[model samples]
Target: MIFPDNRYRQLRAIQAEDFHTCFYCGCIATEFDFAPPKAHWQSYQYRQLSADNLQVPACKECVALLKPCTMGLVQQRREWVHTKIAAKYKKAIGVYLKWNEDELEELDFSLHHSIAAGLKLGEESHRRSNFQGFSHEIDGSKVADVLPAAMPIVLFDKQFDSLKDAILYVCKNYPITQPKLVERLAEQGNNIEAVVMEIQEEQEVAQFQRQLKIQSAAFAKKHNQSARFVSNEVERYLDKELAYSIAEALDLLYEERVKHYR
Candidate 1:
């Protein structure tokens, strides 16, 4: 479902408060756009489709350019933004370096600490209570690192319909890296696959458990006894090894069924 009118107004207000210019091209923002192109909202179940989580101010140009963009393109844009910001800061630092060594050292230390503080504030800004309190304070220093970086854009040689496909591609191509960012991307890929596999396994196990429970209930009904009583009796009688053997046998039977059907 789409946002209601009142929620849309609220979202616009929030977007205006958070962003005055286009996030990508730095033009005066005409409207808010979803960073992940709202079109792909169906891909994420955990992320709430709200202003705070998804909205970013954009000019017409950026909106048009990015509306059809892939996740790889999005990652490239984000990294470009970070690289630009870092360059700007470094340039300012280079100007300061024209001073004596002592002054340069002081400025270097100050900038480092300031950036570190901004990073901390950006991280904490995810919390609703801290967002309003810290946003304005760190606005100047807040960079693309504030958001989760996408897996390396270079890995996407082919089109990907989802983030999972993009991540898997990256993992397959660049399995190891010494750079911290690449390492983090590799770890993220591993974690996503691990989590997805774990969830699938858990769901299959749950389905099997439910089927077993239903069978136990049916057996209990046949014997004119409570399901819980029958289940407990079965559990008591079926040792761990026996249960494992039964599961193995069931697996073989299912495999045979698949073979026969094929």
Candidate 2:
């Protein structure tokens, strides 16, 4: 999830309407209460790598949606570990605390915790605190990396939220082509490589589907199937890319076997 650090915003954005919706189920039920705030990183308070949490006022469906999100390979990366820690600290510790190098050191907390941890305090308060004393020490990094870094990120901003929505919602919506989608599917005890291969296979399947559509239309016209008329008309503009030479074979075929199929 793209947890926007409000510190990233150099300018204040007007929060005109409620945009905090259940990221997974697509429900905007702000009326739902935040249950006993789930603190994933509280145990790491003194740990070298404990970041703040990302608590949201989620309805039941939305909370359920997070189950899949909890499991990501991105969570396993070393960078992600420090990021989680940074995110947690960002949440639990406010901008007011100025660090002297001697007093504190920063590490990637998200990588340590393996997921974005939401602290006890909530959305509105999280925003106010996110910007109270912003720093921009890591301005050169990418937005995702910098969000949890010393750089400023506008936490829960609409644009950032939209990006988060796109990440989760796209993973949910596509569930196949998205790389994160495969990672989540693997975490659920599903076959990881198999899921990935399925995505790789999808292009072949789609090509076959189009091929069938075109071939069926041709056969229909020959045999006069009920839909042949419509198929022939549609065919005028369809099947424009089926041409190929004998020098190459389809992706899966051995040369001799390909000749048989041809």
Which digits, one per residue and each the tens of the lDDT, describe model 1 over residues 134-206?
1221223333333343333333255554333444454445432222222343456424445434445776777
Best model number under TM-score? 1
Q: By lDDT, who's the top model here?
A: 1
User: How far off is model 2, as Cα RMSD?
Assistant: 19.8
Model 2, 81-130: lDDT tens digits are: 23333355553322212111222224365532322222223232233322
TM-score of each: 0.26, 0.22
User: Going through the candidates in order, what is the number of backbone clashes in each?
Assistant: 0, 38
Q: Give candidates' CA RMSD values in order.
A: 20.6, 19.8
* Runs off by more than 4 Å, candidate 1: 1-190, 236-239, 242-262
Residue 130 miss distance in model 1 (angstroms)? 24
| lDDT for each candidate structure | 0.43, 0.34
